[model samples]
Target: MAQLAAARQGTHSTKTRAEVSGGGRKPYKQKGTGRARQGSIRAPQFTGGGVVHGPKPRDYSQRTPKKMKAGALRGALSDRAREGRIHVVSELVTGDVPSTKKAMAVISALSLEGKVLLVVGREETTSWLSLRNVPNTHVLSPDQLNTYDVLVSDQVLFTKAALETFTAGAPTGKSVKAVAAESEVEA
Candidate 1:
């Protein structure tokens, strides 16, 4: 949550009375008129004046433990699952080529609406291309899934291969050589 908050653009800013333009000197004398005395024309009570106690540009981030970030992601996934917004498919057919039409058909068949987060395997480039063109749909590999995307999306669709690989857990620092060696043992 801290990281997500920091990533947001905090450009909201409002000038104070001092920062407002055209407030060079006092607008009127202190004991001149029978009416109330006046200070600068840019005071908060005046029209076209600076806002009082308004928002300002500032960082909205806090340091978080590594475990806490992981827990947040877990929480988001569980929430989506609890809401019954997760769907799984064995595979998507775009014929021998990437077809956007086929992707729309699949979405309509599943009765999915709103922004859809489609997760497929890294090897399924065609599947990714096919669905990426659909309106309000985003395609990503299982490894690219994150808390922000999961939380923002209304529906989460996972291909069977991607679901299995993602459920296996994130990859550690092990290199391809180490992983391959593990798969092949000595005689």
Candidate 2:
């Protein structure tokens, strides 16, 4: 089993070159084809290149068995718990459009200072309106959960509903199976 890494506790996993794609075979032949001596069809000089099968748009998804996902989630949560980097509240009640004041109050109540990624079972326009203006604070749903976002934020606030939703794939819930330890920057 892969060591469960947590963004909060300084443990993070990065994708290996294999996970990326490209390098499959040689480009063209070294003989007289009037064209530049190539190696295989996969050469980078061509439309594609002599790279092993370069990164394709396939699923970069890692196969973490059901238990692993659960374990990883638990491990991540446990890491946060150990560091007290998580704040779980019963609900994330915001006004119709999400008043920043209310959102600020929530942070104040939780005493969650610094960058925070507030996770909910689902994103709401109100919360969006409220937290969007904040520099480091951002809201996300379970499905939108990813390693980078979790890592960027100093803390993760999971509402009870969101936690339940993450644990169970319900009609309204989504899964956050990716390792939550990456930066938001696109790979």
Per-structure clash totals for the candidates: 0, 31
Candidate 2's residue-wise lDDT over 1-187, tens digit each? 2323322243334333343255555544677788776554434455543344443333333455655655556566556656768777776664465577777788888888789988776545566567767887888887666545565678888776666665554354364343333221111
Q: Which ten-residue region of model 1 has the weakest summed lDDT?
A: 178-187
Off by over 4 Å in 1: 1-9, 59-65, 75-90, 94-96, 104-116, 135-137, 147-155, 173-187
lDDT of each: 0.76, 0.60
After TM-score superposition, the amount by which residue 57's alpha carbon in candidate 2 deviates from its true location, in angstroms, is 13
Q: Pairing residues by index, what is the TM-score of model 2? A: 0.51
Per-residue lDDT, model 1, residue 185, is 13
lDDT for each residue of candidate 1 in 1-187, tens digit (9 for 90 to 100)? 6667889788899999889989778888889688788788899999988899999998888887656666666677777777878888878764569887777788789999899999899988879788876778888887777778888899888887887777766576532211111111111
Report the alpha-carbon TM-score of model 1 versus the true structure: 0.63
Candidate 2 structure lDDT? 0.60
